[model samples]
Target: MKRARLAWAIAGTLLFAALAVAAEEGKPKEKRKGPRLNPIAETMLRIDRIKAAVEGLDLNQEQQDKLAAIRDGFEAKRQAIQDKIGDLLTDEQRRIGQEKLEELKQGGALGREAYQKLEEALKLTDEQKQKMEPLGKELQELVGATLKQVMQVLTPEQREKVQQKLGMGKKGGKKGEKKKEQ
Candidate 1:
């Protein structure tokens, strides 16, 4: 819980920095540009870690195929969300746009469906779930560490620029934007 919380904090801070950067631009550019990784990217990285571990397991072809399908299914769903975010929201709205992005990250209706499918496919035994719990927690910490490292490497102005691009500051909010309920 501590690790997940820390990771989320770092990710949120990084996103805030991106939003600040975007605000610096005299006008909202069609897209805010900056060096940052969103939570979605971090989640995908954790999924990849899971995939790698699962791949090393001595499972039968059926298990392998099913797991691959599970991974692909979630990846595709994530990609779809990313595509929608880019097209649907304005550049300013996209920055500081943590609420909706987090909603998508937490998984919406589509996410629940995908998770159900993954549970079916992985056939995770109680033991497996227990083992995976710690791994998942560790992955969250690693993501947080990475975000911190990235933030440390960048300048304050650069950080703010990234935040602006993300619509995180006063200059970045849109009129119609609403906090997406998880």
Candidate 2:
């Protein structure tokens, strides 16, 4: 009887151990972080915001084609700036920059804080910072011109829709701000 009891105990222990092992094996493996993005570019953030603002607008085929043409025309200039930025960053720096941008985007940092985040992420040597300064200026100009061209293509109603989506108004306050009493 003792032998029988001992055998059952051993069998139950083995079964429990086997079940535990099988449960672990059945779970999906945790994914390991992969290679970093090739280049981390903040230029995309502004471009993306503009696109998000207008993506759902009801534009005719003609308007769509016109906007597409403008974007295509600007592509070469944008790509040149991107290439220069890519040349300036090392792989590790790109990875760090990506992490920083993701953090800032998630945090919804804007204006001064956004600029500070980029400055922090760039983390370049003085010489590299100097080289980046002009590229940064050029990128800002390109983005501004692109935005202006894009806006001009939209009808007034469509422009208002885009502006509201972008959280701006004629008053230049964000979409939600308390008006000052006269």
The lDDT leader among the candidates is: 2
Residue-level lDDT tens digits of model 2 in 53-165: 87889988988999988877776686565567556667876676556655665787643345445545555665555455566557557767887788888899888777777
- Per-candidate clash tally: 23, 0
Question: Per-residue alpha-carbon lDDT of model 1 for 15-94, expressed as tens digits?
Answer: 32222222222332333133323333334433444434344445656645655555455445443433432343345444
For each candidate, the alpha-carbon lDDT, in order, equals 0.39, 0.55
Please provide TM-scores, in order, for all candidate models, with all chains considered together.
0.30, 0.54
Task: Give the Cα-based TM-score of candidate 2 against the true structure.
Answer: 0.54
**Candidate 1 off by > 4 Å:** 1-42, 45-116, 161-182
Candidate 2's C-alpha runs over 4 A off are 1-43, 91-123, 171-182
lDDT of 2 at 85: 55
TM-score of 1: 0.30
Residue pairs whose backbone atoms clash in candidate 2: none
Task: Give the Å shift of residue 165 in candidate 2.
Answer: 1.4
Highest TM-score: which candidate? 2
| lDDT at position 94, candidate 1 | 46
